[model samples]
Target chain A: MEKRITFKGVWLPLALIAPQIVITAVFFFYPAGQAIWQSLFIPDPFGLSMTYVGLGNFEFLLSDPFYRASFVTTAIFSTLVTVVSMGVALFLAVLADRLIKGSGTYRTLLIWPYAVAPAVAGVLWLFMFNTRVGVITWYLGQLGYDWNHVLNENEAMGLVVVASAWGRISYNFLFFLAGLQAIPRSVIEAAAIDGARFWTRFRTIVFPLLSPITFFLLVVNVVYAFFETFGVIHTITSGGPQQATTILVYKVYSDGFVGQDLGSSAAQSVILLALVALLTVIQFKFIERRVHY
Target chain B: MVEKRGAGLWLTHVGMIIGVAFIFFPIWLAFVASTVEQQAIVRPPMPLLPGDKLVENYTRALTSGVNAPVATMLFNSAIMATGIAVGKIIISLLSAFAIVYFRFPGRQIFFWLIFVTLMLPVEVRIVPTYEVAANFGMLNSYSGLILPLIASATATFLFRQFFMTVPSELAEAARVDGARPMRFFFDILLPMSRTNIAALFVILFIFGWNQYLWPLLITTDPSMNTIVMGIKQMFPSGDDTADWPVIMATSLLAMIPPVIVVISMQRLFVRGLVDSEK
Candidate 1:
């Protein structure tokens, strides 16, 4: 919406916007352009020269088994992280919403984890599940199950997923609690009067009401798992135990920085850019619908 | 809540207690490990209570432990976080004011340009961004840590959203009073936006403090490392037995500032999260 009254002056506005425009152009747009441009060319080894390969890098990425595997890994990782975190959060939010007292105390205790960095969260979890000194690993060993993420691929993936999901629970819990509280208590009370059990009332009257927030959190959690879980994977597993835990973002860093495969990494970056653009579109579309509602 | 409480209320409390315990367990374990001596932690299932070696472990970590002292990393982190939070707030506030308050050429284009940045995060364009930083000689510096991270479209949009809600009559009245644009902005709009600016500051401060990959890529020097990235470097390479007590102490130290901000400014933090995401 345009303001009905705006001051007349081009210079002030220009001066005001200059900083944002310059930073966006230099840091954001320029590098984005470079990523797109460099994706089309392959650099020869020995840090020498670039050859125009057009679609060769993309084709290589698509055909390569490992690149394809990372796509699958990313999907699996995001799904697992989203579901585990959101499920636990929903359970806690429902319990918190039902409380008459102590909810604020519970919330304060639960929400501090949101301030913990994903990388730091990973270290905490890593310490818990570390091979030798890990308390959880030691307990599991007493149960006759040898828990070693360092060597086992599934264990490695599990470790990273848990670590990533750990900090995320606080965020999802906050949103879910807000959503749950927004639901009319009268509706649930009416359901109770109609002889509905607590579980039945939640399933019939509450779950549908919470769907919008659920969908919103789903998108946010997936986007988070896609991009922000880099630290979790880096600290916990390093995408180890035979690349079993390497999500797409991790692969971009490893290939581009560590392996020096510029073309493939740039191609991967372009592909990821497309993925984020699609997700952002979906998110905005959802927001638009919510606004209309 | 609908029915009289009996077993259900007790059950609810139990469930919440369990949830809180689950959330707090990992941090508690880290705190426990941080207080103990190295030998106590190296053994399986370290002591649950706080140990006598708290002073020793924390002092070691803060003074002369690991890759670089934790104190230096904390100082670097504070600077980067403050720089990013202040820089983004200023640029975003000015640009958002310009976009909302001025009818200018290419206003729509500028908005879309900022909007497009919302799509691609730094992770997608890491290599090229790294090269850009290197070309600008920004690596291993505070500018490298803060500048590339400060073009936040979220903060800009949040300000723009806030500005659009401001009554036009306020501006009209100001203009009628012969107040210039800058004067009106400073006296009227700035006062009105105090809550939003404070809210965005809380969120942005946490974001800047928690940064990992950017600092990891840019800062090669240990002296320049932020606390979040510095912890990873504390782990001894090549299996010579990591100093668990010191590492845990550093981990606890890394979380203090952000956690304090969140707990103290919780209302603003929640408002910022909901608004910025919107």
Candidate 2:
């Protein structure tokens, strides 16, 4: 995609790009290279020497119970967060799209939460479910259901997932609404004129048309759950309640910083790097195909 | 119009209202809690309505409350967010200009190098990046907080995509007028990119302000903490009751800037979000 007409200035262009290149090289590439390089070596407890053991860290992570558990936790956490957020967003977007008026008002009301930090969202939810003096918790006590995420593993996981999902609904909503509005009116009108019911029309036409955006949001939401929800987990549980809510990212932090297991944590990071690269490739590929449309 | 509706429209309205309420509930509760006294919150079934203690709690939070005063954290956050937004926009503008407007050596390689950074988020390289920052004595500094995270190429790619759509005749005219490359960039291209720069600023500002883990890792100093990460530090560890009112007040203050940006620039925020993701 070279421009038909371009300025001829080698030095100027190089200088223009130099800042970004330097930052990227120093902060981005250098650290990424280090993560890969460090994954194969284990540091002694004294911080005196490194042992070169190829594939040993990877092997240990694959078989380690906690690492395996983190993997499962990540899968469950990401899936639940993605499903809950996307489902709520899609439902809201559909209803908002159908409104003849006040959609913008609803949008304004709903979208500001996107600006709320994930950590703040976690704190807000935690405050409500605080077990003591928590309005929601106090109400649940009246219903004979004790709500305590502090000790309950599933409850802790559920709380973090919900908190993470709550902040993401606005982002998904915007994309879904845009996708819904992009559907040609005549196509939907044709379906309606053919005597299709609302649910039938939606399931047959609208849902199919929305698959692209849906798939895109799935990847985005998964990535969000993977990385961005660190704040949520940190504030609410700190991956506590017996490490039940510790997703892979949290594990990397805890093991590297807290546990001082550099080799295994670096291994986990390398795996995560690969996962993101794969997802980014898929996302870009989809964008490329969609560009034709 | 597709169809004029009565029952269905009412149902949609009901659904949308419920959705909006669900979205607003947590923040609304936080705001309510922020206004109430500590005892009012600690007691079960806190008042749902706004309390008269709003001024007292917020003032306490800003002036002399918490580990670090909320005011200081807010100032730190403001600086970090503004630095990240302005820095990212400036560098991205220059790089995007170069990519779109000039033919240069190692251009494609340089572009791909920037592109590759997009795939590796800060979380994956946290340990090594932290080590890098620590080695460079960048910890607890504003540059450390802002620089590493702004390495993303999303803004650059966005500007490049936009610049491609700009007609070549504009540049031709500038060249014919004897404008130098940078002179044309400053006088012509920059004016054209104002909307994009503004839109990207809104999104980047929110991103910078909402950052949690990086600041948490680097800025261990109480005075250096950003409000977003500082809120967690205010929480008590043991059975001791947290200053709920003050914490809630800090939460409200922490969110205000980003929320104001989003609401005031709703259109640009949405445009930047949609455009950047592409």
State fnat for each of the candidate structures. 0.80, 0.83
How well does candidate 2 score on lDDT at residue B209? Answer: 98
**What lDDT would each prediction earn against the true structure?**
0.92, 0.92
Error of 2 at B31 (Å): 0.7
DockQ of every predicted complex: 0.82, 0.81
Pairs in clash, predicted candidate 1: none
Encode model 2's per-residue lDDT on B59-133: one tens digit a residue.
999997678889999999999999999999889999999998988889989989988877467998999999999
Give per-model TM-scores: 0.99, 0.99
lDDT of 2 at B122: 94
